[model samples]
Target chain A: MTAMQEGAHVPSVEESDEPKMRDVFSDVPTDTGLATDPAGVVIAELGDADPRILTLSADVGVTLAEFRSRHPERYIEMGIAETNSISVAAGLAASGFVPYVFSMSAFGVLKTAEQLRTGAAYNRLPVRLVGRLTGLAMGFFGTSHHAVEDVAVARAITGLSVVAPADAQSVISLMRATVDREGPVYIRIAEDAQPVYAEPPTYRPGELLRVREGADVTLVGHGMGVGLALRAAARLAEEGVQAEVLDAAWLKPFDAEGVVASARSTGAILTIEDHDVVGGLASMVAEAVGRAGVAAALGSIALPDERLEVGVPAQLYERYGLTVPNVAAQAKALLGR
Target chain B: MRVDTAPPATTPAPSDGDDGGPTLDRGRSITPVELARRADWIRLQTIELIDRAGLGHYSSTFSSAEVFATLYYRTLRLRPSDPAWPDRDRFLLGKGHAATGLWPVLADLGFFPTEWLDTFGTAGTALNDHPDMLRAPGIDFSSGSLGQNLSVGTGIALAGRLQERDYRTFVLTGDGELQEGQVWEAVMAASHYRLGNLVAVVDANGFSGSGPTSDAMGIEPLAARFESFGWAVREIDGHDPEALLSAFDTLPDPSAEQPVCVIARTRKGKGVRMMEEAPQAWHLGHLGPDLRRQVVEEISGRMP
Candidate 1:
């Protein structure tokens, strides 16, 4: 299998050779043994399987080049027009074609929000919006490229399904699951590839995937934060602290019951995500926990609601307390340990 | 505030008053004379609908009546019985505040019961100032935000090309809405993709909400701009049914390599003397019963 040649490198958190979570993060692996362009491969496979599947790109050609070659007739290049591309996808969906529009997360979700809102979601069309380079993955590209607030924007649009897939396997699983889902779907993906899931797992929107189980505290994460949570859980285990891990792959239709159940079991919950401190996983958890009136102590480890500096992703992650050690420390703090 | 379910006080098919002959119906083809009569009726009903609804964009709707009438009556190939027919030509209105004008046309087409037109802007009504495809049938796509419907129409045209279907997609945009940057993006994409199946008609009414579109943001030399982006361009009198008919009739085949754009120069308020004389003032307003009566008389007087 070919490895991803371009984009940011996402190291695997499931590495068995590392003893400490800090060491695993510092010793970032150059390869994760995952397929090259996992999202593109899934799209190409879908095009092969279904004739109605059509793909559109807004000058983000690297990830979808394979799909373009495989389904030349099915691909459309909109050339740096993210706003127009979204409405085009809606029009295509309105005419019995399933359109998957690809663009950078910031532009695709924020820049074209009105088109996504009135054109796709309000029309209740099945236009798949694949927003790549999520979060601060475009580390040195400054704030214009980072998409930390896409979840908030997408979630606010009624009838839009918001999803974040952590790794290659989850990308395949989630893409296939939501292919025919009613209404428009916004899929958030980062520029890294790691094996977060040991195998392809079944996906249902609004449900949390339990990655690990513990009794002391729950570490709920989505997107790349899922892998970070797993590493933090492993680090807590070394200290004889049991940390339950949940992968919040779906943000919209969030599993309130599962969240309440986890809080009931663990008594403490720390929501982690590569998004802002508000209006994301933490906010969603807070709403659910608040509505359920669950007495579990709740905390969140997320990016500050301020301007982020330009640097490599790892340095930025460390600066924002997004490393495994910080996550574990936050979880322990929630547990008052 | 009234949920008026009464059929709109407008004829489904306006009759030629002298002979009492049906001038225009749901047929896919109509004479230029019939087209002119239907366009006048669209203006008359739009004034009535907005007059009842208390507020609406009268000038924009007035400017687009002839284009809407021309497309629905003579240009588009649609199965009114099956509004969702895959092969039907798609029409999206970018200047969607003018939707009151389209509501009456869709009702006349039998896409929905004519009674639905009376419920415009009322509580729980499907019709709004902006078009919503989910609430109403015969609307190809919902559009309220300016500069979006062209992209939607481009998308439909692209899909038709990929599916090997020969259906065309028409998008009517206001000249004021051309100030939006996304419209240029759609213009570029339509040409770059060589979407012959796509047709965009710009209602060059010269006036927007604030004032003349030139003062708001100059999108003048509109034909040259479209041609620079590789579209086959033509400019005509938007209010003239014969000009509108010729523009639609002369459109290139869907298999052609270039997309077509008809830059329709039109008056903001084409029929009513008060509105035509002062378009900016009438961009959006409530026509009280007295002015509403005068507007109906003006429209009826101009009918062929």
Candidate 2:
């Protein structure tokens, strides 16, 4: 955490010329696949679109620098308390202002879960929670910084809309799409994510995008996992396996229709995400596919529910089998290859 | 008695002073005698409402009875007939368990029908132990949890400033509620934004849900604590309507851009002598019929 805060100069506690912690992942160029900072840019643009929209940063206004600079009056720096920030955002929402509370996923969903439930979700206020650097995207920041069950925590709340934009485009698109809703919305602003769409695709909630089409198996990915799923699909294509990829953008009002359709068409489903294997995209997809009465052989790939070894995201991806080759192999296994 | 749905007749507005500060609705039209009488009535109503529930926060409600009476009758600039009146001053209950005391005041002011009070803490009742803004129209904000409403109040106060609404937002919290870390978060924010329109009143009843607030998690040096947060702090006797009224009036001017916090010393189960000093969180539960009658008699006999 101190290392992340200090940014450039962080002294090593362990004595080594080649430090295992930093040196191993330093040259890997920590690829979070984010083309542009999402909330930092999109929310400011939304301010231009709707004057009633306000950006609230809970000690992380630095992430929302663009919005703060452009609309200084509308941006509220709420300090370190996420719970109070949510309620403040709720009050602002109830008073007819759309408050986009940009916070860390570690604090936003988990720390403020109760406040989010009572103030935003229960009241159904349009308090947009931008959970930046979700999951292991922050890399080596360890368990406290990692938000594994943000989806599970957020989506459990009745009215909260959980979204994970695959890349910069979807963050922009989803922001544009759900900005007008008079209910709570939680978006995981991830980094190290690659663009799945060629250009900014039109985002309609509950509609899943078919990033790739095939007849063999359906590769389900969400947020940063979309990149992993696409990589796996490409790997499968090289091995003569025609794998179709689907992006579950909106998690609460999940694209159940598209998931079931893909399951029925492909007859095999391999779901993956940069989250735990429980209560996230994998759980959501399994429920959708099962309730739809589809007999797709389902296999889910996700981080295990335990304290993960601290490493760069790329190393963690390989160790946790969250890479393209691993996902491709999972697809083959789902097909009984 | 049926609740009056009509707005109360406007009183002679408070005379301007040298300070030229904005005036709060302090017992306007209603005389001081009537204000004290109504505060007694609110205590009576809280007893009845909690009695009906079979289990409720009697001590908590009693603690804030006068604060409720003073604010609704005199301090808050409200339009109970139009609960959503845009410019009406807002009253938020951070100590939500004590909402029973506020229920009647809202009803009597025409925020809702008095009949709604009959359904408190019952199935299909809009009035729960904690009020909900969605269910009850006059509730400026809903609260079930502690430390939350003050933050919401901070937002409403910020709204008043941003929109130049001239309306004030008041949050009434229990002393125990200060134990919640979120409350301090809001206190800092209120000061940062210089939300002069926000007035926070703490009902320092000394007890929380489980025990004495000091015993539970001591946040002593309470006034200095708020002062450290950059709010203008005032210590008052919460049980006295006149004191409460004067405290409301002396709050920081909106032009000053500083929020105010009133630390009103109060007692849990205040009017009911037996429950007043009952040790440890005598904070909840209903008195059985026989004891309930005795408590009511004791409270009424003491009223002026």
Task: Encode model 1's per-residue lDDT on A224-269: one tens digit a residue.
Answer: 8888889999999999999899999999878999999999898898
Task: Please give, for residues B51-121, the per-residue lDDT of candidate 2 as tens digits.
Answer: 78888888888778778777776667766556776777888999888888878777776668888888887
Q: Which stretches of candidate 2 lie over 4 Å from their true place?
A: A1-35, A291-293, B1-27, B279-282, B302-304
Give per-residue lDDT, candidate 2, residue A12: 44
Where is model 1 chain A poorest over a 10-residue stretch in terms of lDDT? A1-10
Q: Please, what are the lDDT tens digits per residue for candidate 1 over residues B1-304?
A: 2222233233344433223222332234577777777878788788778877889888888888889888887777766666777777888888889999989888776788988876887998988899888888888888889988898899889888888898888899989889899889899989888999999999999998888889878887899899999999999999887888888998888889899999999999888889999998889998887777777767777665
The numbered model that scores best in DockQ is 1
The sequence of per-residue lDDT tens digits that candidate 2 reaches over residues A125-217 is 899999887777665777777778898888788888988998877777888889877689999876667767655678677778888899999
Candidate with maximal TM-score = 1
Quality class of the docking in candidate 1, CAPRI style: high
Residue B128 error for model 2, in Å? 0.7
lDDT (Cα atoms) of all candidates against the true structure? 0.82, 0.78
